[model samples]
Target chain A: MIEILLLVHLILAILVLSIRSLFTAVILMAIFSLFSAVLFFVLHAPDVALTEAAVGAGVSTFLYIWIVKRTQKEVK
Target chain B: MTTTLAFDLIGYLFVASSVVSLYRVLWGPTIPDRLLGLNVASAQILAILVLYAAKEKLHVYLDVALVYDIFGFVGILALTKFLEKRHRKGE
Candidate 1:
């Protein structure tokens, strides 16, 4: 079960790098943080999981989305 | 014995379904479609956590899942707000 989640993380990281849009990449990164938090929980580190969920998924995602919005090109 | 096996199976199923949602996130043509996929994936993740916590009889995992739920909600709220603001600016 844990192995499968790790595999998903691997695949998502590769997809994040390969995506063309900055917005999609940011969203993918958010998903990455989520799965990693789960991974930490399964590994018997509940405290780490909590921190990862709060900072990685919550704070960082908001910050990345803000960055993307500030730098994107307007569509015609 | 049977109950444990059933819980294990359901957990795997949820994970698989989340992977399927990832396909949409990877190939979605529009921003909203990707966001939809992301939302589905996060919900599925929450389900998995709850299922495992029940299976292992751990209360701490439940708290982790709760924090995860709160963070996911706030993150999505912020994301959509940013998107909405961008959309308005585009007009």
Candidate 2:
């Protein structure tokens, strides 16, 4: 089961890497980070999961959005 | 069994998103966009590492994750500052 989960996680990671839009990528990455946090919880690491949720879903997403806003260029 | 399966599903979702994020990093027109992608990727990796540490029952990996968190924070701040400097210089 874990193997299958890992496989799916890997596939999603690849998908994230392929998308062209920055906004879309950031949103997707947030979703990805959330899942990773869940994975950590499943693996019996609540502390790690908490960190993931805070940093990945919260801080990282915020940073990306900030950067996107700062640039004002949506193309490419 | 159900719990494990749930985690598996979640992991797959994360993998999918990470893959999509790569395109942004590869073709981002601006440096900040690339930096954002990189930052998101690092966060995801940190999560993955923590999960692995738990699965493997290794406490040491937690330390690695902590270090990664610090490094990632500093790195992103540095990059942001650099970009701000460049933008100001361009003005």
Task: Specify the highest-TM-score model's number.
Answer: 1
Model 1 Cα lDDT, one tens digit per residue, B8-83: 7998899899888888887888988988988999999999889878988889889889999998988988778987
Off by over 4 Å in 1: A72-76
The TM-score measured for candidate 1 stands at: 0.91
- Kindly report which residue stretches of model 2 are placed more than 4 angstroms away from their true locations once superposed: A1-76, B1-9
Each prediction's whole-model lDDT (CA)? 0.87, 0.64
**Tens digit of per-residue lDDT, candidate 2, span B1-91:** 8766765566566656665665676566766777777777666666666666665577866765675577456545645664576589783
Binned by DockQ into CAPRI classes (incorrect, acceptable, medium, high), candidate 2 is: incorrect
Q: Candidate 1's residue-wise lDDT over A1-76, tens digit each?
A: 7888889888999988877777778888998998999899778898899899999889999998887777873322
Interface RMSD of each: 1.0, 9.9
List TM-scores for all candidates, in order. 0.91, 0.49
The global Cα lDDT (0 to 1) of model 1 is 0.87
Highest-DockQ candidate: 1
C-alpha RMSD values across all candidates: 2.4, 9.7
